[model samples]
Target: MPQGSSKKRERQYEHVKDSAKKRGASESRAKEIAARTVNKERARSGESKQASKTSTQDKKSASQRGGERSHSGSQGPTKDQLYAEAKKRNIEGRSSMNKQQLAKALGR
Candidate 1:
């Protein structure tokens, strides 16, 4: 969001935002995700002052770490992740549904 940032960072932010939006995230949520992602990268690269412990510890880029496990990959969303989404959607009987059932009910 800040001006005068590196081209790479700006591009990363836009990419993240667009990706989130495509994933059906709300505008604010997409922006938040993009900002968090870019900030994490900035912290990892020492471009920002604040550094998260995870960012400091992990040497791999975010993409490199999970590039192969994206939404369209064989590894679908986890049970907990689906549960969180179910909660967001206020799905009924979510507590009783298994991962597959949840995914089916959510039409994912």
Candidate 2:
């Protein structure tokens, strides 16, 4: 937590950090995520002395945006993830399927 942060920000940092860890982020990564989230929030609310352009101008708060951008890579969900879903659903001929076929089979 940053120096002189309010109790609310401190609690928010811990909550975000724990949530990140639960989602399989490493300890360091979790800390970084928490710090960034809290800092951005502080900047948004004008609690900090210095703020970045994007941080202050963002339309949505960190929690409000949620993970809208998560799992949206070059082609969205990875082939492995699609395959696993296909396997669970027992899609026909899934074993011989490529990434696109798996996605199509799984109706992604």
CA-lDDT, candidates in order: 0.87, 0.90
Cα lDDT tens digits, model 2, 1-108, are 989999999999999999999999999999999999999999999999999997999897655788665555556788889888998998989889999999888877
Candidate 2: which stretches are off by over 4 Å?
62-108
Please state the error at residue 44 of candidate 2 in Å.
0.5
Candidate 1: minimum summed lDDT over ten consecutive residues — where? 67-76
Clashing pairs in 1: none
Give the lowest summed-lDDT range of ten residues in model 2.
Answer: 67-76
Supply the global lDDT for candidate 2. 0.90
Query: Can you give the TM-score per candidate against the true fold?
Result: 0.53, 0.59
Which pairs of residues collide in model 2?
A: none
lDDT of 2 at 60: 78
Candidate 1 residue spans exceeding 4 A from truth: 60-108
